[model samples]
Target chain A: MTTFRQFMSSSSLSTVKDAGTSAIDSLKKAKSDPSKPPRYSAAGLLVKGAKSEEWPRVWREHDLKKSYDVVIIGGGVHGLATAYYLATNHGITNVAVLDKAYLGSGGSGRNTAIVRSNYLTPEGVAFYDRSLSLYNTMSSDLNLNVMFSERGHMTLAHTDSALRTMRWRAEVNKLQNINSSVIDPQEVKKLAPSLDVSPNTRYPIQGALYHPPGGTIRHDAVVWGYARGADHRGVEMHQQTEVLDIMVEGGEGPDGKGRGGKVTGVKTNRGDISAPIVVNCTAGWATLISDMAGVKLPINTHPLQAAVTEPVKVFLPTVVVSGSLHVYVSQTDRGELVFGASVDPFATYSMKGSLEFTEELAGHVLELMPNIGRMRLLRQWAGLCDMTPDYSPVMGFTPVEGFLCDVGWGTYGFKAGPVSGEQMAECIATQAVPKLIAPFELARFERGDLVGEKGAAAVGH
Target chain B: MFGTRSFSFSFERSALMMLVPCPHCGPRNNSDLRYVGESHARPDPNAVTPEEWRAYLYWEDNPAGSLRETWYCRAGCRQYFTVTRNTATNEFENHPLPGNKTGAVDPSFHYVSSSVSPSVPTTSNAAQETETNS
Candidate 1:
């Protein structure tokens, strides 16, 4: 079997060695006694409530610094989590996270919050399973209640091909030690009683891939937890600060057209701040951000719309998905049934919600659960997804020096946030792509070594 | 119980309806057309390098603003044509007509050059220009 380490060219290996030396030197210079946040505990909560004391701000507002060791582009879960890990795990605290809007204003706040690891590919299953473990421990680690409801996940199969794919995914997941299996219609009906599993229904449920260790999390809490944690550890969080362009020297005439030089700094709306490294964590605007550095990515931005019905009694027990129907329905703790379909048929940056989406979503959701036809939709909105040719993400080093990418997540970036941040922090500190993410390098596209996850990624989240 | 509550429908009127003008057919709902992706210039096969070939095949200038893309009138004329649209607003520019190669449909509208062109000839101002020039 070929290993990911074997795929690394000798030139990149030499670069890693050079970077390792600098990384060690920087680590030695980093502050050893960074300030910590106020610990959250039952005793503290009781004391505060008894004393009628107000809780402090979750994160502090910081003035734009002249320079930093690293600059992260987005303040979403990926960026904030990376900052948190860099501060906590690697002790690299001279990091600045810049966002054009408030934290969690983009895809971080908009995802369906479904978390699962029952993937078809071994690489995908292993990577996402690690994320699942991280999420399992995230609430306590962050000292924030992420409300992780591990109420299992189900992907229904309406056809034989879909069932065969589910079985293949189950076996692959099992080989990776993930708790996933193919269950018959009777079992699925038992799990989700609201589903119309009767043979008379349109696209009757045949079977499903049942994964017990999958469910949803409070996405906003995850973002806030990471932000507060990173902020406490001397990492700066800059909101409403838009990055205008990236400064690169000796790279195809400063246009980022060719890939040879290093990033010097970033020009933002406030001012130009110098940094040795810049990480692009912006999802919807991934292509635009990378384009500023002249590193072209094979990514297109498409809007994925989702809607929520009015709050009612919580009837749905588990997260239900159907790829053929192009819809996934999951009820929130607030008792609102959140519905999401596949991305719009065409690529456009516009995020306007359409009545057509609601109409079709109503039809599909009714087809799956005939009893929900009368449920009134309360609100609908859209978020941008940076889709790659292969449904998997593009992580780690790009062709340009000192510029790293954690983009091309498409529709499933939220669930992988924790692991992506942990690995990205490691990558930034060590200056080398980790083995787990080496298969997802941007150069893979050039080499035609694509990690195809369309089977599991599309409409499954 | 379903009939007891009167539906209070409130949605964006503009986004709910979109009209795409097909050259063969009159203006119709956008659902009548199939959206082809951004147009790209295919590299010359005989002289193209591997990197160039791959870049042409995969790399996209996915601009957030105006983009020139192809659309097939699947439900209308069953023909393909190019239109310059602002991706940010989902609005088409200058009432684009098919087979207008001269790209001066509206003198005020500037054309963004793309490799793909409409093969079908149609009655448009550009066709009249061709006739007059010939």
Candidate 2:
């Protein structure tokens, strides 16, 4: 049997003498006198402006401690929001969020910022509806203007099969107390005068699933708000801190490969930080991060490309999506039309934008609205998505003790960020999976109890 | 508000357009092929447990670096073959040739003869021609 000293030396954690003792003392001191960040309000802004005083930084930087009670990998919206909720709801402030890059550098800022809860499954609809409600009051709760625009969202159905699926989704959404309905082509054209409802088009609009509560929000502001809130509550946010490997102790894993073990700590580039619990919130690198803990996840990374056009007059009033065409479009507050498509045809981690994506997107956008032919695309980019076989996320506890995963959030991760963070925070605090997210357990795949959401989540984001 | 200015449409060449090379057919666009994700060894059905069976069906070794995957030439030859591709850079290595069948077959893949069309030139004919020439 390998001794603890021998295991530490075998790994890259030999430099540390005592892992959590000194850090726990410092964390206790920080908890005793938690310094709150300055609040954002119109009165406070005017006072600062009148006094000619510079505003303080949104979040302060801190030195990496030797240990934390909870270590959340990935500093995106989900991780930051989890940290925020953990501090506020559970009063667990000894949490650290680590990121390989700056906060919101991943899918959090890369998504098209569309938020809706009209889903095909009851569980999916209920979960995402909670997220939408959180987003509705986020401006006052976070003291940051997320700039949420509740412009109605419309998902067009081009074929009879697609219309039937939309009706099914509408029924499911209604049963869950969500405001969704199936509208005809006349209603779709009335809602958005820009769309072509004529019969001469290649894919004529049959009907649409319209959700009046859906719209877009400022994605960066959401990330910043969560980071600021978490920091104010004594949660540490470490940027450019990459986790190299995870240290696990006993328990025989599946296939006897030593996977089902207790997570002791994670080794990073800076040094080894021992923590009792580690949460994997990384989207594109979900499988890789979990694999470091000897936990295999059913996830494949694929790049989803999105493009934005030059600023023009705001012609689109509502968010329009076409599942048959595999494209979704909405005009931002700046009048720039943001467009996103389905995940790429294959699994890849590369975020490099492809010419084929822009070409296909342009053709489809013009097919839906031929009047926008003169609109030139300003820029295009891609974000990595962790796609699962069932098109839903995998949350809650794994076989490995103290290693929780909130991943497998394919194309629709951004919309579910707030609720995922809330549920995951409750799970960490209570040491049990919450009832809302219990259906998304990693063991569901083994039991063939997958929550299939492909019809609503494919290109509907 | 339509202007009379002629629109000169041109995109930068930096954007990637994947070109896949098939052994039977020459180079074709990636759209012409169906991407089968990372290949895995199938365990025996009779002996495999439910956990192992589900893991085999869903789990993937989705590395950011070089990965060996299978692709089907749907538009060209309609044949399934394996190739090593770099997921990060979108680069391919060890391009399969017509006569060379040494490293192409994966241990998990079972070769089916009925899938191949007789009208198309088979790899055996190309190997026989190389043997005669040599």
Candidate 3:
């Protein structure tokens, strides 16, 4: 089977032709039933001259509305999923999701798509576990094949301290009813025989925190499914719509810091959108967007670079992570070895990958598995990570009235996309911070009550 | 002869290296240095509220453009120094004289282990300009 990248590269002409034909057919069908959500199933293969080539557009184009009940910035997984949950769960369908560029073009497209809930903190574990559960039923929920391969996830511990921390994490995960435990190196080898667990190497594998339910999934499909579901529920998905500024009505707020100023609407590149509620779901540019609403967040944007090698035989059966080496590697369904590293030391908005990153990444991967040193890197890319000092997300209502935030998701945002969306929707609907995400509020910083997941974060998640 | 000459240059892609102007070692590749993040003056803990303290500890300018930052010369002088660099362009402003710099180096800048030997500043303004433009 060809990889998604390969198919896109090799069959551009045929794909475009198929898309054009299918678009025309769908447009004709839409005229008969305007409310019909585009169904993309296996039945397309039955048609003459068709070999499962044509699929309906995942989302429809939408014009900018003068006003919306809620306006969500950033058409990533979080934004689309928030819109989806708000419509389905809360009956809030008059929502508009605005994106500066194409959907899922930010961290949603750039993440390695590893899903797991083996976090250290209780708040972290509960929150991410909820996300993992949502991902478990996501394929059926959205009627889209998300391809969530639950092969398992193993985090290798190289030192005594790392091993101790793994045990701690295992206990924490177990308390949350998550099937996670610390396993011996022998058991680790049994799960993934390709791993170099020998003691001869530098920082040899002491043991591993094995979580059997954690695995990888198709990230773009998740985004598309949520977007489709949201659009089907009458939520507007506007692409290439950049939000320039957030209009705020200055007033004495409950806090009396002028934070009571209400968010009137937002001025976008397309046009002005009058929204009662404006949600900042932009990851990397979260601080910039929040600053426009007169809300300051403790977020530093840094680039996290990742690279994927040419597809080889699927020898690696599980996701392998080494926080000591500052690298994580997992093989995709199409056999490409996806590798991720820690965020860049300095803060920058530039998504340009550096040669230093490639060099260091190769060296670190070689340290973990010397056999794959010959694997040629296909391509390298970088995505901005909004690194919080405490390494946790900033969610819930900000000081600016009606302006909510779901940002500061440095590395693990992709894993927690669903839960963040559901909880963010709840927060917006009820105007009350959900218990699961209460500890992650923007006010936590002021109260000096931080949920520091820096131990499990910073490098691998 | 057909139109005005537009000087064009082919850009070479490599490691995105920043030039750190070290007092003892002069300018060096960024790989040989360690970034200490944006330097901020510590507030008086006794007087400030928890909010102010948290802001001082966690809040960062994180500007996309030029700013003064602290960097340690790990491979060279083994000294901490402050340099003005454009984060977006990765361009280092040349400090003409020692006195014109950000005074003494920040002692808080921590060094990372590196084997590279200290070298004199070899980067030129024209090279940086070319890099930024490209």
Candidate 1, residues A1-461: lDDT per residue as tens digits?
55667657555666665655554444334324224435666555554565676666778887999999999999999999899999999999999999998999999999999999998788888899999999999999988899999999999999898899999999999889999999999999899998999999878899999999999999999999999889878999999899988998778755644488689999999999999899999998898889888898988777888999999999999999988787899999999999988777667776777788888788888999999888999999888888887788999998779999999999989989999999999999999888888888999879778898988964642
Better of 1 and 3 by lDDT: 1
Using all chains and alpha carbons, the TM-scores for the candidates as numbered come to: 0.85, 0.85, 0.84
Question: Could you list the chain B TM-scores for each candidate?
Answer: 0.55, 0.59, 0.55
For model 2 the TM-score comes to: 0.85
**Candidate 3, after superposition: displacement of residue A1 in Å?**
34
For all candidates in order, state the fraction of native interface contacts they contain. 0.46, 0.54, 0.45
Cα lDDT of model 2 by residue, B1-134, tens digit: 11111111121111236766566775577777767667666688899998888787887777766676777776788886766765666655445556654435333332211232111111111111111000
TM-score of chain A of each: 0.91, 0.91, 0.91
lDDT of 3 by residue, B29-131 (tens): 6767666666566678689887777777776666655556666666776665655655555545544223434434334332222222121111223312111
Candidate 3 wrongly placed segments (more than 4 Å) = A1-31, A48-55, A251-258, A458-461, B1-16, B93-134
Model 2 lDDT tens row, A172-255: 998899999999999999999999999999999999999999999999999999999899889999998999888888858542
A1-461: candidate 3 lDDT, tens digit per residue: 99999888789756766776785576568658766655654333333235554544667888888999999999999999999999999999999999988899889999999999999999999999999999999999998999999989989988898899999999999999999999999999898887788989977999999999999999999999899899888999999888888888874533222377889899998989999899999988887788778787888777788999999999999999988778889999999999998777666666666678799889878877888878999999888899887789999998888999999999999999999999999999998999999999998878888897977762542
lDDT of each: 0.80, 0.81, 0.79
Prediction 3 global C-alpha lDDT: 0.79
Worst 10 residues of 1 chain B by lDDT: B1-10
- The all-Cα superposition gives candidate 3 an RMSD in Å to the true structure of 11.0
Going through the candidates in order, their DockQ values are 0.22, 0.24, 0.20
- Report candidate 2's interface RMSD in Å: 12.4
lDDT per residue as tens, model 1, B46-73? 9998877777767777777666666667
Cα misplacement distance, residue A349 of candidate 2 (Å): 1.0
